[model samples]
Target chain A: MKNLLIFGVGLIGGSIALKVKKDAIFDRVIGVSRHNGRSLDDFVKKGMLDEIAVNVEEAISTANFIIIATPVAQTKNILKKIYPYLNADCLVTDVGSTKSEVMLDAAESLGDKFDQFIGSHPIAGSEKHGPDAADEKLFEGKNIIITPHSQANKVQLDCLWGFWECMGGIVSSMTPSQHDEIFSTVSHLPHLLAFALVNLINKKNSKDQLLEFAASGFRDFSRIAASSPEVWRDISLANKKAIISDLTLYKKEIDVLVEFIDNSQEGNLNDYLSKASSTRSEWAEDKK
Target chain B: MKNLLIFGVGLIGGSIALKVKKDAIFDRVIGVSRHNGRSLDDFVKKGMLDEIAVNVEEAISTANFIIIATPVAQTKNILKKIYPYLNADCLVTDVGSTKSEVMLDAAESLGDKFDQFIGSHPIAGSEKHGPDAADEKLFEGKNIIITPHSQANKVQLDCLWGFWECMGGIVSSMTPSQHDEIFSTVSHLPHLLAFALVNLINKKNSKDQLLEFAASGFRDFSRIAASSPEVWRDISLANKKAIISDLTLYKKEIDVLVEFIDNSQEGNLNDYLSKASSTRSEWAEDKK
Candidate 1:
């Protein structure tokens, strides 16, 4: 009967909390947030968490595992505040999008006081946010990346993996640097593209044109751009290094596409479309 | 009651047929195809078309409105075959992705058979295809662009507008060149980008990395690349000029993004993000 303390009971945390309660995996699931009273009342009424506390010390006092699921910018401060209350046996992990920065922040804030700290990122979520918007199935059939430091003990790392796996995520371990590098290309760059597309059409001359005749293609490409600005801003700032690298690579690829379009002789045009089509087809086949 | 002849009973044409039938505006919805009885049989069985014909002669013998909704490459051939069957007062149009090449094809194929031939592009579709995928709601709240020549009669043009409006689409008019140019940037270029992204990942040394860890962002971004290669190839070839211009602009945007990422000055990062964000927001605001 392991006690679990979930901090910031928002979308990701609340979702996991609901699943844990339903599965009866945790002896006691304590949800801690600034508005813990509301969380407690709601959870009791809805039966999500067994207990809730606003104070960090009280919530984590008997907890064997702690999950920090706050926004990236707020994470460092929260880790610093919670460091003094965490026991030697307690395993602490997080669910942030960016990893390298959070790892560095955790190391700096927790120092020797925190023994078992791991960084985890669940590669799942819609553009929507908040506890109310979260679904228990959000993490099902999704990838959860776990970045454990070299100093992390096997017991704690295994526990963290088990917990994430229980939430219906397929857990894979990577270094914080690797996690940042991979997600920068797959996720961060795409969000940037969506945002940039939005701004491109937002221009004064394009306003009427876009409104009058923008198609489903444009709508689908721009959907994620409508996401929470605050969450994205923090992610961009935190994962700047890997995102920048991936952005450079993506630009190079787009340059190749442009060259084909710019030099559109029949021969060159044939080559361009064929190359793109072949490449896309093979890659698409691999996913299924 | 106006009579309509649809050349292809695939997704776009079939959906249009269903809507036209449901609206009760058209006197007859006739299907023409080389698929013997297969395609037309499905449409008739589903109650989309009033009748099915194996040859162009029987299909357009009485139709005042002829719609060539074949794949881009097949459009010219279909238009030519139907030209001899068309009535003197018939209005010829298409529901293809690319307009310029089709306009040229229509002009060449018809010669002097009719008073006017208009080109149309409905910006609506699903990843799914064939007559089975057709739905009356396919064009609901969608945009339809009509590329009418100066020679197009007011009656024919107005009829074309009313036709799409009846199918629940918001209609906008543009010249052939303008239609090609806009869609090149909005549809063709983004599609090429998706293809290129898929190719880049496929060419990576660690292809399994994508298999084990690729998330929804990568999945959605590359979804369009999964579209039929034949359809896309025709689109790429047909709208070469506009698609080329768009591919170039997209390259330039990507280059700018790369530069900011390479330089990594905190001050310049948000500029890229903001540019995309603003454009997408404006696009989103144009729901109609």
Candidate 2:
């Protein structure tokens, strides 16, 4: 893309900007954010962004591509605000974790402009946040899921796929609904469990002692519990339909396991745990 | 101590044997197992053990310090078999994952020999097992929980503490009940959640799709799910009371969190997540 405009320049946004600039893939990179701050200035100083713009319309006038790199919860409002100003030929896409809701929001706010929207999620990020945490090659050797609805433009979809490929992403395509369902199980549910687990330990009377004696297993298990609460809360609520579905399923499984343990049924418990361990081992083998 | 006899020379037992032998802390080390195997012979060849013994009574006959490194479920039977053979003034101890049950088992089988039993748990071990996986410095810079019951001999207790300290474990004493409770929250509960999480996803119709798209978060969160099913099943059952208590409380927290997400109550969800994130950060700081 010759001209690129990016909104919400945080970890994902900043990384993309830095990477594209390093690869010399874009001729002009325009940055737009809610607030002007040292971070934005640092981005410009680092040559990731050519300039920061205060006017959305002005930024859209010259752009052939736009990426909404904000939380899923903010998708619709931002789409509504920028829809009128978007260039007719420019394609718009997002980097939100949840896809179906963002697609619904795009369809609602953008109307005819919805054809330009492609919902994408790059499964590469650290628990750290902000532009300072952005890595020049964060998207290298990562998986990127592009969720396109029925109305999505074929050319734009392929173009977005190629764009991510240029940044070294292994791109895959699926329906927005399927994307949400899969992620809710693999990504969102794990975060929900970690947050609750950490909170439970903290509220216990033996909190200090528990933390003191916690070993490497505890550290690895709860590392995600230190993730940005704001980002996770937004993702959890915005994707509530998928997450709640997984959570309900998860609750049922946990209840069954608890009953087996309480009754001291060694064979049943072993069968349950063995199934999980074998599956995990199989997956790890595939990963290798 | 001299003439150490270790039963069930797996990872923990083998590691202690290697460390004590390397440090020249013991005059003789004898490994006892229920089966004759290549792994036991490998241990002898590695110099982790001076010999493998089939006669538990003959092995116990000359030992001043004996370490039972078997699973918690096997504690009572092993104690019963060795109690009659243990020499007077010789101190017997264990490396079981659960404390109170093992202590009770030691008491029941040993009878008047109860004072010779000191229950301890070294909070350092990998998921790896067997003689080949043993590390001479496994316990170095690790915490060892020494739980000696009311009837435990004072000299034996002190001697066990010093023994662990000599292997670089910073030893601390706590009631067996406290050790069970603390580990239930930090260790057992997380393992339970991981096993259930993996099983839930595996049983799903889209299991392959979910595993294919799973990310680093899923990998780290479910690493413990790859642990020994039999070992964890034993731990879960042996420490059922503490685990059930934690699981019940954990179920409640998850229910409330699920409710908040379903209703999209940003304030409540944010507050709950914030508490966990902050507590994790605080603990991480303490670790540093």
Candidate 3:
């Protein structure tokens, strides 16, 4: 029986456990979390796992596979607590938004004792969070990026990919730096923009009036601004350099657009329109 | 028997006509349009309309309700052409995004006959255009703003509201100026922002690379920018003053955010996040 133990069993880890339970690959599944542990009860109620461990050491003592799914800032501390009980052959991976910071933490805590520690991020989430919001198909058809350092072994990497595949993600691989740079623009900077716009609107002293008239445009534009402040604050600090660069680049671009709108020259309007249309059209085609 | 003459039988007009037909209200429904009039055939073949008329004068003669759903710039010319056929009692409304400009055009073209016109903007649409994309439920649970000049009668207003209610929209009355000012922020500016963002992305020489890496964030942010450029160009021009003002306001707001990020003070981050959360939470509650 292949033993699987999932740590920090919130939305991502709990979801992975649920998907893995659908198959006969794991004979025993265990979850370890620091919360009220209602998720464990819910998981059992849903038949997602066979057992729950009250502590990290007990969770990893007999596990063949371990997945750390916690906020990036919390992973390092949890890794230290579980290290003493982890087997030398226990394959390990994590689901953290920022790979570089978490990678360093993994190195410090897991060292060479663990079989492998691969960094992974599934680019799927919503404004809502928590284990109750967990969907077994959360990662299905979504992009899963894995960043394995030089020390990672092929056997462990293959097994990690097998786990992610079982969870319904289309797996891809990138270096930590590449992941940070790309997501900074595609995710982090956009969230910052939404938050900034919402703040500006609120400062107008017509927040209630504006809310009364808030249409679909404002709703969709600022949806991400409603995301958990703690998560974004951590992300904003962790990916600060890349996010700052992307934000600067976007501001400069918006300034150029402001110039064209102010001038109202038919030529500039047409130019912007054609460029925007072609770009959005191309992007629209690539959606999975 | 209410005779309904719908001009520019495109998505909005066709959908309204279909809804009215389904309710079995209008005694006669006729569609008038240009562009080879292919959409009119779909409406007639689908039994949404009783017949089609090629000329504005022919369609408007002896009609009780005239709905103008053409582009804002073209609306004036159509009104002028049909002015001779329109009776003093005939009620006129439009489905244009900008109300003030269209109202002005109607006032100029009709002079003494201007009393017949009531400017309207139904805030429901998809990026997809044409009658083929039209659905009977397009306006269900949507807001329709009716902007009437002082000359509009209560009977005419109530009848117009009744028509939209049957088509499944909550009707609200406002002045043309208010409609223009409010939508300039809520709808027009957002579309402009999306367009501008898309144009900026396209300017990147690494277009293909960006598109390949484009995730859900970029896709949703740029969705509105993918709308028809021809339609947007007219809207931007029609509501030029308000949209330009909004653009300026947005630029200033964004600049403040940029400065805050440049400073990188923790206090500033908290301020931005707090203000945004407070406003967005209120807005979200209003939406519910």
Give every candidate's TM-score on chain A: 0.92, 0.95, 0.93
> Which residue window of length 10 is worst by lDDT in model 1 chain A?
A32-41
lDDT of 2 at B48: 85
DockQ values for all predictions? 0.38, 0.86, 0.45
Best by lDDT: 2
lDDT of 2 by residue, B87-203 (tens): 887888888878988888888999988889989899888978887788989999999998988877788888999999988899999999999999999999999899999999988
Candidate 2 C-alpha lDDT tens digits along A114-195: 8888889999998778788998789988899999888878889889999999888999999988998999999999988999
Q: What TM-score does each of the candidates earn?
A: 0.86, 0.97, 0.88
Q: Of models 1 and 2, which has the larger TM-score?
A: 2
Clashing pairs in 2: none
CA error at residue B272 for candidate 3, angstroms: 3.6
Worst 10 residues of 2 chain B by lDDT: B33-42
lDDT of 2 at B200: 96
TM-score, chain A only, candidate 1, equals 0.92
Evaluated at residue A252, the lDDT of candidate 2 is 90
Interface RMSD of each: 3.2, 0.7, 2.2
**Model 2 lDDT on a 0 to 1 scale:** 0.88
Assess chain B of each prediction and give its TM-score: 0.93, 0.96, 0.94
Clashing pairs in 3: none
